[model samples]
Target: MDRLIEAIEDKQNPSVVGLDPTPALVPVQVMDAYHIEADEYVEDDDDNLAATGAAAAYFEYNRAIIDAVADIVPAVKPQIAMYEALGPAGVDCYTMTCQYAREQGLYVIGDVKRGDIGSTAAAYAKHLSGFDGADVWHEDAITINPYLGSDGIEPFTAAAGETDRDLFILVRTSNPSSAQIQELELADGARVYEHVADLVEQWGADTIGRFGYARTGAVVGATHPEEGAALRARMPHTFFLVPGYGAQGGTAQSVAGMFDRDGSGAIVNSSRGIIGAWRDDPRYSETLEAQTALDLVAANARAAAEDMRDQLRVALA
Candidate 1:
């Protein structure tokens, strides 16, 4: 948590770029360029060739974005599901992306959202701890699911302490359907998320860093401005990993209150809005060469990240 906070302070940007890529988000030209390599390596395995090629393309797309925004943003969050969809090849791509982001001096947050109990939870904690002393996953932090209770979360907290990493527990999410569970009213009149917020604060109580935030942070959606504001006040010690900006309709103003009075305490995330910015550029053409399209992708991503940073500065101001 201290490391992440310091990185954020150094950049003067309380924002993170989400490195979530999909076939639709990546340029077809770039995808086509990797087919030959995939075909050569995955020969005779018709079932795996397409997925392998797509995964390769996704990595290149991610690398372009990371190289573009590594200096402007403090962190890069690669949602695992995007890579996991491509099967084993995609998982490898996900780890490679994390390693690359870390190499570029950016904090890598694995948006894994893993949850379980006991030893199973311990296995998931390996994302932070690594295997046999080797940093396999290369994540500085990860998102966790807390529905399974303390047993599901304690292992991660322990691993974070041992590895000097951090975790953000899902409390209030950005998706529309999140309300179906997160907003449920308990008998005590507090919504489920509020209770989760309280627990999150407690979970990190023993692990507060130099910035007065816990190693265990909370995932609060940027879409619910009022709720986000209230959560800021309610969970003073819990830092926030806020999603739903840009493509998800979360404006800077909508998320401003999630920050502390000093403009700290939260890091907002933008995925498609940054990585997929090339799609909205009129100059981008499908007929362009693969490297040319990638160059365009990098330029658009950098511009979008810069714009997002400026918007946050103004909103916080």
Candidate 2:
């Protein structure tokens, strides 16, 4: 938690670029550039070649985004599901992306959202605590699912403590369907998310860092401004990983309350808005060379990240 806080303070930006790239988000020229190599590797397997090519393009795209915004933003949230969609090749791309982001000195937040109990949970915790002393994942923090209760979360917290990493538990998420479970009222007259928030605070009680935030943070979506603000008061020791910004319709004004008085405590994330910025650029053309297209991606991403930071600065002020 301290490390992350320091990075955010250093950059003076509480925003995290989400490296959740999909096929549609990537430039067609970039994807096409890898088809020949993918074909060579897959050798007659069309499906494998397509996946391999997509995975390759995604890594290049991620690299461009990381290189563009590494200095402007403190962290990056790479949604694992986006990589997993392409199977093993995509998983490799995800790890490569994390490694690349970290190499550029940006904190990598693996948006895995994993949940399970006992051994399975411990295995997932390995993302923070690398197996055999190798830090394969290269993530500084990760998102977790709390539906499985303490058993599901304890392993991650323990790993975080041991590794000096952090975890953000799902609380009030950004997606509309999240309310189906998180907003349900319990017998004690508290919403499910509120109860979960208390547990998240408790989970990190012993791990509070110099900045007054615990390693166990909460995932409070930026979309719910009122609730997010209230949670800031309720979970005093808990930091926040706020999502649902940009492409999901969350703005700086919508998420301003999630931060503490000093404009700390939360890091907002924007996926498509930053990485897909090139799509809206009139200069983009499908016929452009891959490197040229990627150059546009890098330029657009940097501009978008800068715009987001400026917007947040105004809102927080």
Candidate 3:
């Protein structure tokens, strides 16, 4: 658990790459390299492409992104929906991506957002907490939905404690629809999410690492800057996994409040904005050469990431 905190502290910048693979957005070279028709593959459930080229494309795209940003960001988060849509083949790629990310010395956050009953939840925890077996297990932290309360969270909490892994509970999510529920005020005057935050903070207390931050964390969106800041202040020792940056339109300045005084308490995540930027951003693509296409696209993406980090520094300073 201390290793998790130390890894975050060492990076200084709390930016995380959200890997949500959309086959249409992958570079042609990557597509050609593996003879993968990702767009067609994702659409056809019974297509043989699922087991053949689709799985290969999944690993290739992720490997490319990891190579590009591994040096810059603290972690990579694979949105489970993208991988799970492919079924077991996608799960194999997810497993490969996790292993590759670990080898690159970056943390992996399984953005599965799973919430279930106690017995079933424990099964998920076992598979995801890297306790089932090293091959198919996820060694890093995962996101959990607390809508079911302690019954859903208890199994995850237990697994995290045993494995020294971490869980980032969804307190105030970034999606627009979240306001309908999370913002509802209780008779006690606390918003529903506020109470969730308090509970998450309490759950993480025993999991605190030596660096003064806990393995228990929260996924607060960068879209709600003020709320994110207020939550940061409320849970000073908790790690924050922030989404909604880049493609979701969250500016670095808007999310700057997530950082502590030293600028190391939270991580901002960007998925389509970083990986799929080449589709619209010509500064990256518009290349004819295969190698050049990969390099230019990767370069532009890295530059955008660096610019975001610089803005965060300015805002924090």
lDDT of each: 0.95, 0.93, 0.79
- What's model 3's lDDT at 269? 86
Error of 2 at 143 (Å): 0.7
Q: How accurate locally is residue 241 in candidate 1, as Cα lDDT from 0 to 100?
A: 97
Sorting all predicted structures by lDDT, with the top scorer first, yields 1, 2, 3
Candidate 3: residue 317 Cα off by (Å): 2.0
- The sequence of per-residue lDDT tens digits that candidate 2 reaches over residues 1-317 is 99999999999999999998898999988988887778777756476888899999999999988988998999999999999999999999999999999999999999999999877999999999999999989999999999889988889999999999999999999998989999999999999999999999998899999999999999999889999999999999999999999989899999999999999999999999999999999999999999999999999999999999999999999
TM-score of each: 0.99, 0.98, 0.89
* Each prediction's number of clashing residue pairs: 0, 0, 1
Q: Candidates 1 and 3: which is better by TM-score?
A: 1
- Per-residue lDDT for 214-256 in model 3, tens only? 8778999988999999999999778898999977778888888
Candidate 1's C-alpha lDDT? 0.95
Top candidate (TM-score): 1
Instruction: Give the C-alpha lDDT of model 3.
Output: 0.79
Local distance difference test, candidate 2: 0.93
